[model samples]
Target: MATDDGMRLAYYIVLLVVIGGAMLFELSGRGGKALRQLVLWVVIFAGAAFAAELWMNDGLGGRQTITSEGRIEIPASRDGHFHLTARLNGTDVRFIVDTGASSIALGPADARRIGIDPDDLAYVGSAMTANGQVQTAPVTIDELAIGDIVDRNVRAWVIDGELDGSLLGMSYLRTFARVSFENDLLVLER
Candidate 1:
């Protein structure tokens, strides 16, 4: 129920209308300055859209909180520990607070990600497992994260050597007091 100025209406229906409008305005100008500006704006907008998408999906964006410049403060977790997103050796991971473990246990794959050579750390010590006594190896993790919380120079132990990965044992959990688990989140109140 409308009249047109001979411009294609299909473009208007699907948001290509902006491009058409830009072109029309550009053509109307003898100097073509408007067209150049429109094109520049379109390019800039597209780039910004891509960048925003990447930032939102990336690891850095997931945990970063605007507490201050380059610092993310925990908003006082439930227990003594602050619950936040955690990554093991750059790999996305989920962990629960377990004070029972004497040292950090790495899933077979997690151990490899931390660059723990299976041969270097042998099963010198024994730790109790749900099933029974299990062999273990000594290793260290390059980094550990709980949400935006960062803990470095952490000690970890290798497990399931042939299988790969470890458990987030006391070695890493002891840093905080009384870890809390609620729903699908963990909070370290320290």
Candidate 2:
């Protein structure tokens, strides 16, 4: 695991354990404990629910499951990113669904995975990232699919720097008939 990811995991684990233990201790006693216990449980449950929200939002599992209604649902990751697996050019590429991004972004490695030779591409475009300005190369995905959803000839950029993973940006997400998040599920209906 990356150092950043490891640290985040440790942080959450400690937070949940501490909160849970406190809740249990509060529940063990009786008498004046009624309201206290209730409040404590509420706090504990809220903590857990918050953790769940972060997990589902992170999409660390990178798995998208089809619902009974034929919509796509992606649970969040621990770090609160909606990670999903998309088939790019018939090969599986893991992507973080990023609404903030204007278009799809593929890392150098992911560009190669989708059959683009990074070395041959000209990084004529630029995008501002959290790390500052970075060069980008325009590319196209012949096929990008998440669950049963599919888009062809999708426009994207290849990041010149080392990217943790590809980002599923508006270029593809906009194709969805409806996109919403409900009950911790990133719902996409076509």
**Candidate with best TM-score:** 2
Candidate 2 structure quality by residue, lDDT tens digits, 64-95: 78765658888776677777877898788888
lDDT of predicted model 1:
0.54
Each model's backbone clash number: 25, 10
Against the unseen true structure, what C-alpha lDDT does each candidate score?
Answer: 0.54, 0.80
* lDDT tens digits, residue span 10-52, model 1: 4234335555665666667645566578675985575565557
Model 1 CA lDDT for position 117: 62
Q: What is candidate 2's CA lDDT for residue 67? A: 63
What TM-score does candidate 2 reach? 0.65
Error of 1 at 119 (Å): 3.9
Give the Cα-based TM-score of candidate 1 against the true structure: 0.47
Error of 2 at 134 (Å): 0.6
Model 1, C-alpha of 147: deviation from truth (Å): 3.2
